[model samples]
Target: MTYIIGRGYGRALLTPDGIFFKGPFRRRSIPWAEITEIEKRHHTARSSEWWDLRLVRANGRDLAVPGAFTSNRYDHKFEAKLALLREYWQRAAR
Candidate 1:
């Protein structure tokens, strides 16, 4: 199972070993073993930009992830946030 928390800068998808990134261009991931803690963050987006969702994973080690590629060509970030929640099922214990 996975756990998710959104922040001002990005959202973190917490899995067994780590979490994924989404926002301002999906970025690399931070390993869980290295994560010290998880924080809830929020942000108000500019009216023109997509809704800003973020999560902070406090880890010293970061991992390279698959490129940020969306296949549908929908070009919607809000929908992408839902995709993460679906793909990385939140951990029951988290």
Candidate 2:
């Protein structure tokens, strides 16, 4: 099974093989074995506040899954989707 989440200019696609990220101008594919960590991080800018999923690779590179962007209202489904993504990652890691 595959799961996809996100809106606007970025999205994250979770699959049994890996996680694929589609950003505004680039795309990244990280295989399950190459992923070292998956974390949720809080971000605050001058006018934007949101939370995102951060994927850390073995080579020390970080990728942000920007599905939780909350510019005006909160995205209530963010946590649920985050949990689902983690589940996929854990299953692949095993």
Candidate 3:
């Protein structure tokens, strides 16, 4: 049971078996096994939010999770989320 604190109403969570995300206009889950990669994308000049989470799936689909108000703005929260994601991903790899 893992939860990533959101800056606003959005939230990202990692359970024992999968990842869950709920945002203003997006809500979805990626099973640990189906996740292939997680990446941080560069923010545009127009965007103050410097970081975003890109979720890659085994089927080649990609989902972008905005961490702007919450995870990206604060001190290393994005990294923290990444670490947890990696941990769960490793478990799935096994």
Clash numbers, per candidate: 10, 0, 0
Question: Candidate 2: which pairs clash?
Answer: none
Over 1-94, each residue of candidate 1 has an lDDT whose tens digit, in order, gives 1221223444455576556666555466655444443322232345432222233334443222222223343546645654663344344225
Candidate 2 local lDDT, 45-67, one digit each (tens)? 79777676778889998876756
Candidate 3: give the clashing pairs.
Answer: none
Order of the predicted models by lDDT, top scorer first: 2, 3, 1
Regions of candidate 3 where Cα sits further than 4 Å from its true position: 1-8, 24-26, 46-49, 66-74
Model 1, TM vs. native: 0.30
Best TM-score among the predictions, by candidate number: 2
TM-score of 3: 0.68
Q: What is the Cα-based lDDT of residue 77 in candidate 2?
A: 79
**Which candidate do you rate higher for TM-score, 1 or 3?**
3
In candidate 1, residue 11 scores what lDDT?
44
Q: Against the true structure, what is every candidate's RMSD?
A: 10.3, 6.0, 5.9
User: What would the per-residue lDDT of candidate 3 be over residues 1-94, giving only the tens digit for each residue?
Assistant: 1223443457777787888888765688878888888876666565454566677889998776545323245657667766777787788778
Query: How many clashing pairs does model 1 include?
Result: 10
